[model samples]
Target: MSLTKAQIVENIQNETGLTKIKATDTVETLLEIIKSSLADGENVLVSGFGKFCVKAKQQRKGRNPATGEEMMLDERRVVTFKCSGKLREKIN
Candidate 1:
């Protein structure tokens, strides 16, 4: 099953013995930091988990399957994650 934000907060609280409020704040802060770093074109790495990075995709052509109409896909940035081998092993 996929873990939600609430579950992540709960896990942090349990593991760190922090109050729910503190745990929530810490998690939010960490997410904001990661977002800001990626916005600045930098990567964020959590050693035992994975690395987060922004990847750029080039403009491309595409078609609408339903309408059979051609369209152009604009270039854009996307967030990507590469899981650490240790974490992948544990999950599997």
Candidate 2:
């Protein structure tokens, strides 16, 4: 199961003995920091966690699956995550 933002706040509160509101605020602030950094095209690397990257994609060709029609895909920026080695080992 995927962990939600609420779960993260709960975990932080439980582990640090922080109030729920404080934990929630901290989590939300950290998330906003990461989001804003990515919005500015910067990579965010959290130690022992993972790295978040923004990648630019060029415009290219595409095909419709059912209709077999050709189309053009617009260029875009995408967010990608790379798990840290420590996290990968822990999961494994």
**TM-scores across all candidates?**
0.89, 0.91
Q: Give the alpha carbon lDDT tens digit for every residue of 12-48 in model 2.
A: 9999999999999999999899999999999999999
- Kindly provide the TM-score of model 2 when superposed on the true structure, using C-alpha atoms: 0.91
> How accurate locally, in lDDT, is each candidate?
0.96, 0.98
RMSD of each: 1.3, 1.2
Clashes of each: 0, 0
Q: lDDT at 83 for candidate 2?
A: 97
Question: How many residue pairs clash in model 1?
Answer: 0
Error of 1 at 25 (Å): 0.2
Top candidate, metric lDDT: 2
- Give, for candidate 1, the lowest lDDT window spanning 10 residues: 34-43
Per-residue lDDT tens digits for candidate 1, residues 1-92, read 99999999999999999999999999999989999999998989999999998999999999999999999999999999999999999999
